[model samples]
Structures are given as structure tokens and as C-alpha cells.
Target: MTNTAQPPQQPEIPDVLSEKKLRYVDIGINLGDPIFRGVYHEKQAHDDDFHDVVQRAVEAGCEKMMVTGSDLKESEHAVQIAVENPGLCYATVGVHPCSAKQFDTHAGGPAALLSALEDLAIRAKASGHAVAFGEIGLDYDRLFLTPKEPQLKYFEAQLDLAVKVQLPLFLHSRAASEDFERLLGARLPELPKRGLVHSFTGTIEEMQRLVALGLDIGVNGCSMKSEDNLAVVKEIPLERLQIETDGPWCEIRPSHASAKFLAGAPPMPKAVKKEKWAKGLMVKGRNEPATIPLVAHVIAKVKGVPVEEVAEAAYNNSIRMFGLGSMENASS
Candidate 1:
């Protein structure tokens, strides 16, 4: 007698597992930050040092990225990088609150600084490489960087510039929520509807207030610091959330670590070995845009949603908030 048995059926794939690899858009990255320079090994004379980082990011599924502009010079550099890379990158043009003092010290003082920023915004926008106006807002946490008064003054000036340029705002706020809320709230009616609070580490109440005002929330390592923070993350509405690496800083929080998140992350290029990282830190100490998927993974775990869902919502939300046209256009 001959007997035959069918092979045991394979387990069905979960919808999340069946989906394609999650493509991402980093809504914020300081690609021009000095820390990024020489992070990779020295290359040949003809090599484009920065382009290597961009290539690695794309390979890791971050198809598009918005290089943050924290000041006038950095904003110019960010725009230049974006222009050089075209569809793969874009920029925000504004002075950070920390750099607010530049306004007073600039050649013709605050008026000249404001005029120059306006000129940059106008030029950056015309290049089809500028997506917003910021990295701007109040940051009392780093008061040493800029006194509260200057922070507020320049923040207000940049808000006015954002209004004039009609670009979405890439806002920053820390430890000065009361003042931040008051100032931004007063101007809410005049600001564009598409702005976001980047690196948001605020309370649920604060997050709610921002969402209520039609602003999206940008999450990164800094935003996931504690159980309380993760709890707040769970409360954020999917459509109102976006993920960023905020690289060279804000790697995923230690408490929220998971190998699963890093599974999709791109490996450090051979040119940059683990031993080369800055002292007293792991290889991840220098965060890169490629780690964005890890950010999505942490969000998925905290919110009890599929990673794919987090990735899709974030990718789409970024495109919508930044008016990145279409994924095809933005990622081309």
C-alpha cells in the first residue's frame, strides 16, 4: 500500500508581513550638520562625501528627505544640497531660535537679517527644492544658546517671514511650552495650516493642543525618552504624526530599544566601522536618515500597530504636510 500526505500548509502571512518593504520620508534631518562631515571614512579625491550618505539612506528605504535649515548659512547649504540632489532631497529655510542672535548681529541688524532670510526663502522656494520655513521656535531649555528675549523676538520675526513666504512651518519648542503655545496660538490664524512641531517631547495635553491647531507632530528618539513619552506617542493620531531621525542626535531612546527595529536599518557603510564612532558611544551614536524605519518600528510597538501602517501614514503625512507633490515625483 502506498500512502501520500500533502506537505503541512504554511502559515498564512499577516497583512503587515505580506506588504512590501516600508518606504519612508524623513521630515527632518540636519544633513549639513558638521558632525556628519568625516563621519564616513575619507574618500578618494573625486568622491562626493555627502552623496554617499544620501545614497545609503535611499538604499535603506528612506526615498526622500527634508534637510533642516537651522540658520542662514546652514539654510543656504541645505538648499544647495537639495538642488544638487533634486528629487531625493528638499530643504527648510529659516533661522533656528538658538541662532536667533544672528538677527541682531547681522550686518544691518534685525531688519537686514529678516530681509536676507526673506530673500533666501524666496530663492529656495523658486528652486522647487524648498518645502518649509523653519527649525524655528522658542527653546528655553537651551537658554544659554539664546536668551529667552532674543529667542522670542527672532521667532516672531521668522513667523512673519513664514507668513510672507507662505511656506509650511518646521517648528521647534522645548521647556517653554507656555510661551510657545501663547505665541504660536496668537498667530495660528495667520500661519499656514501645514506646519509641524519637530522632535515633539511634549505631554499628551500639549500634543492635543498642537493637533487641535491643525499642526502635525514630528517624532524622533528625543520624543520617546520615557514610558510617559511612549504613552503620549500612543495618543497621537496617525494622520497627525511624522517620523524623523534628527540625525547626529536623538537616536532611538535606550528604554525603547529593540533588535526588530534595527533589522530594517541599513548597515553602517564599510567606510565607517563601529570602532570609528565618537568615544563613549555605540555605532548608533551618530544617527543617520537610514534609521528612520527604526523610528517607525518603535512607534508601531508603542502604539500596537503594524510597522507598515506606521510607515505608510508617516510617509504620506509628510508628503501632504510638506506638499511634496506625489511619492513618484518626490522620490524620483
Candidate 2:
């Protein structure tokens, strides 16, 4: 038989880019990832074009972005990125559940590791480089990366850090809702500003429960992968909703359920395969903060609201949640 298999189709990019500049705040991005620095799998594939990436995002109306620190080293790097960029970028410092093992394995032991994280958060918060405390929480779906016990233990421990610093949280949870909810509930009273459960791909009930507990939900491409996800997103209260790119990762692809909504939204620039990367172009498989508008477009479509309504609501909710200050002040 002749080979009947077909290569995957590339997502169609609209010919015209959106001219309506709507401001956005990408709540979660892993900027410390080597991909942003033009490194791929431990080797350099292209020149470091991090500034180019930032500039493209600004043109896309993502005026501010929060860089996620998945562990100690990345957390430090995230603060550095925020410091260097000033108001343009902020950092979230914490050990993701996947890296929970780092606590016990640290040279100075778990207490010392926690102490170091506390110190980083304190200084960064004072300097306004760190706006939230996290990228931390449970991820049972990938338990192979970490066990449940330490995830639970240190998730609570970090909650304590959040209380100490009095900063809002940038949280995560996947296939671990029971313990995630339980732990967060126990600490909710202590965290006045609450936090956001980002990249939420949970059931409507889970979303409702978290909202009831006074938390906000963050959506990205990965959060809208299927019809069920769209249904859940539609029900999220406008005031309780926020947006993020979770970038260098969750770009809105043509294959996602959100793609159909991209019909009339802003068009992304040309994308080249990583090996053939150039300035002013996006890497084919790498997501960037610039595509944040597509995320807003999808949410607006699913919720039957205008794209502006979604963008503005998400922007205000993020500014309020992360204490980014009034819109006028922020834009200034």
C-alpha cells in the first residue's frame, strides 16, 4: 500500500495583524527557559534574542508579563530579568511541585533551602521585582517528577512564605485538586490578596470551588485544548478571570479549540523552525508573550463577549490581583 499517512497541518496565520492595541498582562511565563535565550536542549541554536521577544510582545499589547521561577536558580534569574526590565516584567519565586525534591536534596537541608527562598522573596518583593509568590503547587499528573508528600509539605510551607511576604500568589495545580484545594483552603484566610490558579484545565466544579475559595483562574492555550475546556472557560466569572501566555510553551495553535476564534483577531508574525530562526520572527514550535491576544480572543469567543471586554477585564483583574496598580498608573 502507498503510504497514506499525512504530515500534520500548520496553523493558518491571518494575513492582517490586529491594529487595535489592547493592553494585556501575561501572568505566567517561563522566561528563564533556555529557549528564550536561543538555547535548545543544551546547545545554542540561535543568537539570544530575548529583547526582540520583549519588543514583539509590547507591540502585541502585552505591556507587562510575569516570569515564573520553577526553582531556586530560575527564581533568582526571574528576579534578575524583572530588575533589568523594571516595570515591564515581574517575577514569581517558588519551587514548583515537580522540583519539590530540591528541598531535601539541598546541601544545607530543607530548612536552609526554605530560608533561602524566603530571603529571595523578601528582597525581591521590597524592590518590586517580585509581585507574587509562586509557580508552586501540586501536579499529581506528573507525579513521576515528584511524590505527593513533599509537594503537600512544601506547598504549605510556601504558603507560609506568602503570608510572611504579604504578596499575592501565582499558583499551579494539575490532577491534584483534592489536596490542592485542601491545602489552599487551610491557608486562604492567611493570604488576603489570595492568588491565581494558572493554566487551569480543570472541571467546572473545580473552577467553581476555587472561585468560591476566593481565588482567580488564569487561562492560556493549554487550558483550552478541548470542548470541555471551552465549556468550563465560558462559565468563569468575568471579574474572577485573568489571562497568561505561559509562554515559550502554550501558544494558541491552529489545532486548539481556541483557533477558530482567531478568525479576525491579530495575526502573528511569520514563524520559522528553530534552526532557521532570525530576528523579528517567531520560532515555529516555541510560544511567546506576543500571542497573548489570541488567548483573549478565544476567551471572548467562548464567553460570547467582545474581545475588548475580555481583554480589559482580564487586564484589570490581573492588575488588581497582582497589585499592578490602577490602569492609568500602570500605563503611565
Candidate 3:
């Protein structure tokens, strides 16, 4: 096991505050987790665990969280959270192609996953709450479970489902940009309602494809170290951008090595609640939705906008992209 040396903690925020007052959304959060790699290792996401984190986020200036649910059950859980939380949270339902590789009890594996995904989509639509079809796309880099071909197979299948449902698509393209672009190219006519590419860390050409496809780019901890990502972000307009913590699995850190150390602890359940910034050099242990104000802080420095303005713009873009009604209703 890694040295469970607790990383430093962040300051708490006042209760009677609205991040809407500033203007940002930590839109992409994995409130329910299986503890994947990268920025999501601080919180132990078993089945349904989020109240504490949600409270922290509200205080930290993040008024909205568009959680990702990669399968039927997770999607249902996300919807439950949305319904329970009312406006602070919303959800996207889809079978992430990578996770879809595990679809079982079927004559054809890939086909089974697609069928299952379609069923989930139907349920979400029937529930009348699913905002988008997401956490679905290509990932040819990590050889975590199955091979690449199966992932590609179901990715297209889900893309087809998105078109059929006429819902926005929230995608995750990792080390499979060209393949992703080719598949997306074929789905162009229905691309206007396209979704965002979570935790974007690809090349300029890939970024171009994202922009061309009308998809939004999500920035998180890994983005902290990439000048290339910042360069791409600089070129991409704010409307085409978004932010996420992807927590309880991938803990975004101020630096890389630190991120690695916290790469296995369930996303920190929550930081303490209060109303002041800690003095001195800030050390990080876990990443949460609330930690996003710091992300907005950085983006503001780069985009040359007031931190509050960036927060609000990102917040509105998130609501607009995800079809989540309004930020005020969300955060309130």
C-alpha cells in the first residue's frame, strides 16, 4: 500500500454563500465510484455516498455537479442523487465503452452491452430526468480490462443510441482520438447536441476535432501539468470548455507526484466546513467538487477574467450543455 500520509486539507467556506455569486460549475464528478485511476483516488465510492461531498461543494463555490454514471445501476444512482439533491446535482446515463467491455450474460458480448445501454437509456428517458448520454467514448490507451476493439465496437453503438435518443453526448476520449474522430465524423449531422470530452488530455489536432465536433473540453488535475492542454484551452473559447474533479477516484492535485500518492484513497469524503482560507503554502491530499474554485482561480489567471466571472460562465455553460434547467435552481 502507498504511504497513506494524509495529504493537506483545504479551508472551509461559509454556509450562506452561493458559488453562483462567482459563476462556475465543477460539472463532471464521479459521486459513485469504483476507484479508477488518476484524479479520483481520495474518496471511497462504494454504492451511494455523496451527501457529505455535496455539502462541501456547496461551500467551496461549486454549485453544480453533473455526475457521470457509466452503467445501468450507476445511472440510476446518479438520477437518485439528482432527484434527492433537487437542483445541486444532475446526471448523465450511458455505458462507458471501456466499462461496457464487462457486459455479460449475452450471446454476443458487445451487442449485449449495447442492448443493455439502450435499455438504460429508455429507462432514463422514461424517468424524464436523464440530461445526456455519457461517460461513453473511446479509450485505447489503458489496457485495464479488455482489448481495444470491443471498446471501439460499443462506443459506436452508444453513439448511435445518442443519435436515436437525440440527447447530448458526454464523451471520454483517451489515447483514441483518431478513432474517436472517425466514429464521430460519421455521426456529424446529429453532432449539434454533442457532449463534452471529460478530462481532455490530447493533441492539438484532437482538440481541433473536439471543437469541430462542437464538443466541450473538460479540465481537471492532469490538466494542471500540461502546457499543451493549457495552450489548447487558450485557443478554445470558454463556451467550449468546462471543469470537473472526477473525484472519489482520480484526485486532482496541484502537482503530479502528489496526485499519484492520493491515487487510491477514495476521493476525500469532504473538506471541513467554515469560512476562511488556510494561511501558508497549501498542501493537497484529496480532490473534491469544491476544490474547483482553485481550478477556476487558475483558469481565470489564464483567461484574464475575474474569478467570479469565470466561475459563472463555466457554470452557465455547464447548465446549458447538460440541459439542467438553471444554475440558481441547481445550487439553491
Model 1 per-residue lDDT tens digits across residues 192-286: 55599999989999999989988999999888877788879999999999999998688864455333344544333333344453321224466
> Which model, 2 or 3, shows the larger TM-score?
2
Each prediction's TM-score against the native? Answer: 0.84, 0.92, 0.76
* Comparing 1 and 3 on lDDT, the stronger one: 1
- Candidate 2 structure quality by residue, lDDT tens digits, 176-277: 999899988988898877999999999999999999999999999999988899999999999999999898888777788878878887778999998888
Question: Per model, how many backbone clashes are there?
Answer: 0, 0, 23
Which one is best on TM-score? 2
**Candidate 2's error at 213, in angstroms?**
0.7
- Model 3 scores a TM of 0.76
lDDT of each: 0.77, 0.86, 0.64
Best by lDDT: 2
Question: Candidate 2: where is the Cα deviation over 4 Å?
Answer: 1-18, 325-332
lDDT of 3 at 218: 83
Off by over 4 Å in 1: 1-20, 39-49, 253-284, 325-332
Descending-TM-score candidate ranking: 2, 1, 3
